[model samples]
Every structure is written in structure tokens, then in C-alpha cells.
Target chain A: MVWLLVLIPLLLAVAAVLIPSGRLRPWLVPFGGLIQVVLVVFAISSENVSGFQGWLLLDPLGKLVLLFISVLFFICSLYVPGYLSLRAERPTRLFCACLLSMLGMMTLMTLSHHLGLMWVAMEATTLASAPLLLFNSSTRSLEATWKYLLIGSVGIALALLGSFFLAYASLYEGLESTLQFDDLIKLAPHLSKPWLHAAFVLLLVGYGTKMGLAPMHTWKPDAYGEAPGLVGALLAGGVTSCAFLAILRFYSLCVASGEAAFAREIFIFSGILSMVVAAVFMIRQRDFKRMLAYSSVEHMGILVLGIGVGGLATYGALLHLLTNGLTKGVLFLSAGNIHRAFGSKLTDDVRGAIRRVPMSGALFLAGFLAITGSPPFGPFISEFTILNGAIGSGKFVVAALFLLLLAIVFVGMGSTVLRVTQGTPSTPATATDFRESPRFVIPILLFLGMSLLLGLYIPPQLESLLKNAALFVENGV
Target chain B: MYQLIDPILVAVLLLNFAALGASQLRTVIHAIALQGVLLGVLVVVAHNEFTIWAVLMACAAITLKGIFIPRLLFHAIREVSIRREVEPIIGFIASLLLGGLGTALAVLFSNTLPIAQEHVGSLIVPAALSTTLTGFLILTTRVKAITQVVGYLVLENGIFIFGMLLVEAMPFLVEIGVLLDLFVAIFVMGIIINRISREFSTVSTRNLSSLKE
Candidate 1:
């Protein structure tokens, strides 16, 4: 059974909590992440991972999400030692435990075929990650955690109801109200039309809120902006990825029920609205960290919009998931270093980052370019494919609007990023003990390099994984 | 004849209004706690058969949602020592009217669903939905963070009511897991509320406006 994949990190987290040494507990994070990565690689390499009646199968979609989360968690794990060593005054015990448990929950979320188990796992994730926001113990962070919990819990609560409506959908057809994805897919044709539609709407709003989709994306800017950069990266990349995977499972159900067209239309509208919201906020954004938050909102928009446009766009959406995640790792980590050196998130206090921390400043700039779809980066390739898919599908207005918003965000974000990266270091910014350590710095460079490599060459293995996952989502093959 | 579950469900729905119309924090918390107890009873009363698993789940619900979590909320309010919802965004009567409108809408809406024939006339679906809507109303309308937490518990109680529709098909493990998650969520929220009250000297979300751009 693949239960081992999830249980190990959780067990290790408990161990981390029990360990007497505060200094040693933070190190447990990287160790837990490494074990998770190794186990994920092994699970993907060797088949027959299902157990407990097909509830834990590593299907192509799950495999792909598993791979991204593993990579994201592993990289973020490496930075933990560097981050915590600098902030020794603060306690790392709960932070380390929550971080590891979050990985376990995300893994459980992707792997579970049972919708009931998935909801349990998904809600568990919200509970686990809540403390990560409160790590800083500041009033703003406290407020952020408050909004995060209240809004996010309400959102996931709706998802719980959505799960019920879905199970009830099966019951309406005289089938046993089984929530296993395979069973639901097999019985999709017989599911009641009205209930199925209701299920989709609720699941979309519910998971969409978690995914930070527009109108429902209110909590994103607050939590992401207030969280420490390391936690920010995880929330943006790992937490949101789990939520997106949940949506994909439901999207697949829609495909099976032949509500694919209706789902696509809703996805398209939500996708575009998120970008417009992101773009509007991106303009005149003063805080560099908050700018990255809005950027996350935009990329999340692109992910759904890509899939909604269909065909190769689905493949692009899957690939975009990886690129966007890695690029966020680069941006948030580098931004973390800069934030420490400068002690401010706003552009006003953070002038001439290049002069202050040469390497990180350049990265924050390059990350901005790469994320905005400049050439020779993975995001650009994935984004181009989506635009091509839109054009190929004759969604010209969507394509045009997509292009326009991309430009506006690029220019909007450009001013803030450039203002941070360029110019002379303001004199008061010079005296921080914080320095760019190669330990944390190397991770960002590696992430950027990998994104660059993917833009130039799609590894055949990843390409195949994306293709199979896309096909699985679009057609229940 | 209606099953024994219907009146209990009505009591739960009325508690939704009690939570909305009541201004005192303790009273609202008590109403939600009572609703939680009703929902726990709902599981056994609504079940088609009274197996060990069903009885055990109903007990679990009562202890966690009814007794344990509400006690936590009570302590939270006691910690903050705020007795009333004090200065709601909308005053009490208007909020009650809004709650009534939502209850009406929920009743009208559940009729549109193709619920199972055996469960058609039961207040299960509409009561579940309207209670949920009332929870949202309290959450959005109330200013104090403790009241918001109470609103959240009420919301979960409503979802728990809806969860009954699938109690027979759902594994006991999932039902227990759901309750556990709800407990932890409240636990975390309670902790944060204490922190917020200490930090700002007030738990009103109005003071939370500093984080905005």
C-alpha cells in the first residue's frame, strides 16, 4: 500500500516534535522532505502502488503532482536549515512539524482515489498549514492567519458539502454511494444530471477558493504577503498545487459525465477573471512580496485558462504547473534573502537590490522575466503552448485578452521588480547581518537553471508524464 | 408520519435563527452548541438502521461538536472576555430578516434537487442548506472574531447535517476524520483568536484592516 508514502513524513514529524533539541528539529524538515522525494521517485518508478481497494493508486495525474510537490518540498527543505539558523530566536518545533505534515497531507490528497478521503486530507492540509502563517508571531501575520483560517475553512467546508452532493449524485442513480474516483467514473453516465451539475459548481467554488481563483482569491494576497518567504513558496506552490489537483479530479469526473463543455466554459470565465484581477492589482503594486502574490494569482489563472482552451493546452496547463511552481521557488526564495537584507517588503525601502545583494537581486529580476513569459524559460514555453492552444481552438478573444493581461502584468510587475533590482543601495539598508549564503542561493539558481533547461528541452520522461496526465484528465483513458 | 429526525432538524434550524438574532456571544455559542447536539442526534435518528458504527459516530459527533468544541469557543470568549457580538456590521433585526430570506431560499432551492424518494419530505436538505447560509450570515455580519468562530461552528454543524444524507454509505473512518479535522480547525482558530486579542487588544476584524494595501 502507498500509505507508507504518507505515513513516513507524519511519523518523522512526530519524532521531530518529540526530539528535545530545538536546534535539531529544523533539520528534521530537510530529512523528512528527502525521504518523501525518494519514496515518490520509487513509487513512480515501480508500479502496483495501490492498496485499500484502489483508494491509493498513483495514476498519471497523481504521479505528476507527486513529482512536482516532491521537488518543491525537497528544494524548500534545503532552504529551511539556512532560514532557521538565521532566525534562532524563534521556535522551529511547530513550524518543522507543520511543514512535514503538510507534505504528507498533500501527498495523501493527490494519491487518494476516494473523494471522502481526499476531502479529509484536503481539510487536514488547511489545518496543518495554518500555523505556518503564524510562525512570525506578528500582528499582521496574526491577522493573515485569521483571514486564512476563516475564509479557507468556510471554503473547504463547502467542498465537504460538495463531496456529499457528489456521493448523493451516485445514490440518485440507485448505485451505492461510493466516492472512489474509479467507481464514480464508471457510473458517471447513470449519475443524475442536476446533482452532477450542482456538484461541479460547488466543487469549483470550493476548490477554486483554495486554488486562489478570482473573486474567491481574496485570501491569497494577505496570506502570501504576510507569510515568511519559505512558507510563502510552499503555500503558493505546494498548498495551491494540492487544491488544483483536487479540481482536476472533479474536472475528470465532468469529462466522464460529458459535462466537459460546461466545465470548460466555467473554467474559461474564472481563468480570465483571475488574470484581470491579478493584472489590476499587479499594477501599482509597491510591495515586492505582495507583487509575487499577485503573480501567483496570475499563473493560477493561466493554469485553468490553459486547460479550458483544451487540446495541447491541457498539456500546457500541466507543464505550466511545474514551471510556475519552480519559478515561484526562485522568486520567493530570492525575495526572502532580499527582504532580510533590507528588512522591508515595499519598493520604497528596497531600492538597488543589486548593489545590496548582487546575486539575489539579479535572480529576482530574472525570475520576474521568466515568470512573465520571457523566452528561454519554462514558463514561456508552457504559456506559448497555451496561447497556441487557444488560437488553435479559435478562442481568439481569450487569446487576445490573455496576451493583453500578460503585457499589463509584465509592465506592472516590471516597474516594481526593476525598482527593487536596479539603482544604488539606499544607505540605511547596508547594515544587516543577513548575507546571501550559497546554501539557500544555490537552490534558487538550480530552480532557475531547471526552468531554463525545460524551456530549451522537454525531457522525454516529463513530456510523456504530462501527455499521459493531460489525456487522463481530458479523456478518462 | 415523519421520522423522529424531522423535529430535531427543525429545532436545529430554529437554532440557526437563534444564533443570528441573538446579540450576546454566550447565547449564540449556546445555540450553536445545541445545534451541534441536535445534529449528533440527527445521525442516529436519521439512519436507516441503528448499527454499532452508526451509534458510535453519533456519539463521536456529540462529544466533539457539541460538548468539546463549544467549550473551547466558550473559553475563547472568556479569554477575550467579550460578552456580546458588539457593533455588528448589520444590526440584529436586519440580520434576522436576512436569515429568514435565506431560509426561504434554501427551502425553495432544495426542491429543485433530485433527492432520493425515501428522503424527499424530510427537512434534511433545506435545513442543512439554510443553516449553512445562516452560518455564513453570522460570519460575514459579525465583527468580533469570537463570534466569527461561533459562526464557523454553526457552519460546520450545518455541513454535518448535510453529511447525514450519506451516513450509511460513507465509511466510519471518513466520518471520524471529518469530525477530527473540524476539531483541529477550531483549535487552531481559537489559538489564533487569543493571539489576535492579545496583539491588537481587540478581536474585531475591523482592526485587521492594517494589512490591506
Candidate 2:
């Protein structure tokens, strides 16, 4: 059953490539997305979904990430047909094929129970997404794609080496070396401590690079700023979350091995560092899309910070994953609309977006507020929970620092958001004929609606699932 | 069989330096391809027994890294009309010095991690680390897009050398996946380099700087 999750998208990806019509190729994306969402829904509801001789299994953590990726892909898919039709001059063959393959690879990453398998799936996602970044075929987009591919590949290479180190840790102990996640956790204590520590650092840096954490996040602004809004949202939201899941897998091993203290300190430090970096770059930012990229860096910081704080904070981090991913979708999709309507991503040329395309403009404002942790939004609840968890754990310094950075990000991000949303348009909307069509407008609304819904209420099942995942990570089930 | 490993490993390390020092793009790619072939040979020699899995992995590595990938890159250069010179950001002497420094550091660094008893005397760990670092130096110091790709391949070679230590532990599927991913990455990168040259009328990364903050 779990194999189908990966297989369906892969098959659809082949069909997307074979299909002759440029118009019809893109529909495969939404079709593949819908099937994935359905499969994930069933996988979530059912128990013990395992396949491929136990190589793939949808665990609690996997379930949450799978849900986010599938639903996010679905919503993004709804806008694809509309988005592609607008650019009829360009062929959709590569774009559609890559998107579906990426979905398949992401699904495989989540379902992978073995570490090597996870690394492969993660690398596949990077390869699959590179072409998507070059969709515009502009010089700037080409540059962005190059940076993303090279940096991402180097980071993943480190991760591959790290996996080898992990296997060697056991091999050094004269035990049968294996990389099955469950087996590693079982053998954690007996594995060489130095090797484990080294492995953890490499994995963090490698996966963290993919997650767009600080010091390694140089590619984020460029890639996110140059890529289309939909691609940016997926990279920021979907692909980044899968990378986080990879980190969590290793972190869970550290916890099981009783090396939580060592791992936790590093997490807290890097997490705080990422937020500070985001805050610095976001201030006085001319490009609104680039500012959102920084904003993503900030939220990724928050997620890791929550995990580092532990206990209730881990749960907060888990919840923040969902909230942040969905909120980014809202921002990117609406931001895409605004970018199209205004024909520019810079603040100087993109003012009074609210007037130019009222519906997308308002959604953009709401998304900005939600992402900054304004009340009545999903991010507010999640961010506050992380704060409460930090305070509860008596990590007063981390809590204070978290709040300070959040405030700085809010203020920095707010100035640019307002500049884009407020004031009169410096140039008229004649630059691009893109208007607020229902196809594009509806998905952004649905994403915003989901973010709002998640804030107001945590349905019983979701709360339990989040709790189970948090517990599963805190102490192995 | 194990006694022959060190000499070949040392050759691989020398190729790393050769790649670092070579200013010509053709020489650098050839040096990397030779390194890839040596690593592929090292794959079979590193293991105690010549198992089918080891043989298969070695063949694949040689074919993809040594022949197919280099052929693709050469075609890219030929088609795109890229100049032969690497056009490095730093001088060749400095890059060679850095490669030397990186090799020393890798040797020093590998001593900290305890190797298994059988593998303790082997130079695999140190050689792997040094190759990876050299790859990094090339990747960072080189300005041409093609040179950067060569750097990336070298970096991957370093990891592949490291993987030879655990050839038995890693599944065949993953090994193939890694090779396939590397092939596709270079293939995709080759296409992008072609486009970069066509669009900008030059393949130099100086043209790629307009997307900055």
C-alpha cells in the first residue's frame, strides 16, 4: 500500500512526459496530487502501513509530513493549469514532468525507513526541482538554478558521507553495520560515540543546507526570489519540510542513544543563529519575494529551536511544521498573483498591490500577518506554543531570544509587506495582463483558510497525531 | 590484494592535486576522469573478496564517472564553444597550496575517528577526506561553470571513495541510485551550462552575478 504512494506519482510523471499536448501535460500534476492526497488520507487513518520488505513505512512523523506535502501539492496543483495556460508560449513538458517526479521523490523520502534510501530520495528531490527553477528560462532564473543545484548537491554529498560514518560507527564496534533507522536506534548506545557525533554534525549541516538554515542559506533568497511563486512555495514548504524530517530522523536516534544533550545544544544554537540571520537580511529589503525567503529562514529557525527546547517544545516544533508550511503556501501563491499583477517583485515598482488586484492583494496582506504570527492565524498559535514550551522548560534565555528575533523579523518583514500592499502603484497594471482569476485566487484563499482554520481549532485526530509524532521523536515508540 | 591499495590511493590523491593545479579545463576533466577510474579500481581492491556486488559497482562507477560523464562534459564544452582555460577566481599556485593544506588537515582529522581494526592501517579514510576537501577548493575557487562542475564531480568522488569502506553495508539499490543521481546531476548541469553560454554569450560565472542582494 505504501509503495503505491511513490509508484502513482512516478507513473503519472512518465505520462506527463509522454503526453504530446503542452496544455494536457500540466493536468497530470493535479491528477497525481489528488491521488496522493487520497492515499495519504488512507495511510493516516490505517495502521501499520509498510511495504517493500519493510523498507518503506508511514510512521507518525511521516504521516504528518505526508499530509502536508500532499495537500500542499494539491492546492498548488489547482493553480498549475491556470498558471501554465498564462504562459502558453513556453512548453510545459519538462515543468510538468519534474513536478510530478519531485512529488514522488518527496513521498519516497517521507516513507523511507532506511537512512541510505532517505538520502537517495532527498537527492532525487533536488535533481527533480532544479529544472523547475529554470521554468522561466531567464538569465536570472538560470543563475538561481545553478546556485541551488551546486550548493544543494554539495550539501547532500556531505550527508551521504555522514551516512557512511554512521555505518562505520557500528562497524568500528565490530557489530553488523546497518542503516535501518529502527536498528540504528536499537544499536545507538553501543555505536562509537565520536563517529555518531561526527555523523550528526554532517547530517545537520547537509540537511540543514537543504532546509535553508543560516550560514548555509545563501541560496534561499536567490532561488526563491527568481523561481516562480508556486515553485518557491514548494521549495520553501514541501521540499524544506522533507529535509527537516530527515534531520528529525537523526535527532530521534540521538535521543534514543541518550545523546540528546549534545544534539540539543547544537540545535538551539543553529536555530537561534538562523533567526538572527533572517532578521538581518529581511530589514530594508527591496524585493518582497526575497523578504519572504528570509521569512522562511526565520520560521525554519523557529522549528529547530522548538525541537532543541524539547518536551512541550518538540510538539510545538512539530505543529509549527504544518503551520509554517501552509502559511508559506498562502504567502507564495498570493505573492505570485501580486508579482504577476504588478509585473515586478521589487517594492519600488510594486506598491499598492491591494488596489491593483484586490483579492490577491488582501490575501497577501493576510498571509503576511499570519506568517509574522499575528493572532487568528495558524502561525500565531504555533509560534506562541513554541514560546510557551521554551518558558515551560525554564530555558528562559532561549525563550527571550526567540521572542526578540521574532519581533525583529515581524518588524523587518512588516515594512516590506506594507510597502508592497500599501501606497499607490508607481506604474500601472499594464505591464502584465494577469488579473485575479478564480483558478489562482481560489487556491490562495483555501490555503489562507486552512491556516486560519488550524489556528482556531486543532481537530481531535490531528492533536493526537501531532502528540504521537512529538512523543515518537522525544522517545522512540 | 590489500597491499596494492595504498599505491593506487596515493595516485588518486595526486590526481586531486593535479586537478587543483591544472588551468586547462580539458586537463582538469581528464585528471578527474582518471581519479574516477582509480577509485573504481579501488572499489574492487578495497574489499577482501571479489564479490559480484563489488564488481558491478566498480563497473558502473567507471562507466559513468570515467567515460560517460566526461564525454558529456566534453561535448558540452565543444558545443558551447567554452574556452579551454579554467579562469579561476584565485591563482593556480594558491589553489595548489590550499589543496596541500586541505590534504594535511584531512589526514589530521581522520586520526580522531577510530577506524575498525582491519581498516585501521589503510589510507582510505585520509585519502577520502583529502579528495573531498580538494573538490571543495576547486568548487569554490574556480569561476568557470564547467570548472565548478568538475569540482562537484571531484567532491562526489571523495564521497564515493569513502563509500568503498562500507561497500558491503550499503545496499546495491542505493549505490546505483547514487551513481544515477550523479549522472543526472551532471547531465542537467551540462544542459544548463549550454543554456548559460547561449543566453549570455559566455559561460563564465561573472555573468551569473546579477541576481545578488
Which numbered prediction scores highest in DockQ against the true structure? Answer: 1
Per candidate, native contacts kept equal 0.65, 0.63
lDDT measured at residue B119 in model 2 versus the true structure, 0 to 100: 81
User: Model 2 segments beyond 4 Å from truth?
Assistant: B171-193
* Stretches of model 1 off by over 4 angstroms after superposition: B83-85, B171-177, B180-193
How do the predictions measure up, each by TM-score? 0.97, 0.97
TM-score between candidate 1 and the true structure: 0.97
Predict model 1's lDDT versus the native. Answer: 0.86
Give the Å error, residue A158, model 1: 0.5
> Could you give candidate 2's per-residue lDDT for residues A315-426 as a string of tens digits?
8899899999899998998989998988889998898988988998889999999999999998899889999999998999999999898888889988999999998888
Highest lDDT against the true fold, candidate: 2
lDDT of 2 by residue, B6-78 (tens): 9999999999989998878899889988987887898888778889977987888888888878887787788
Instruction: In model 1, state the lDDT of residue A170.
Output: 86
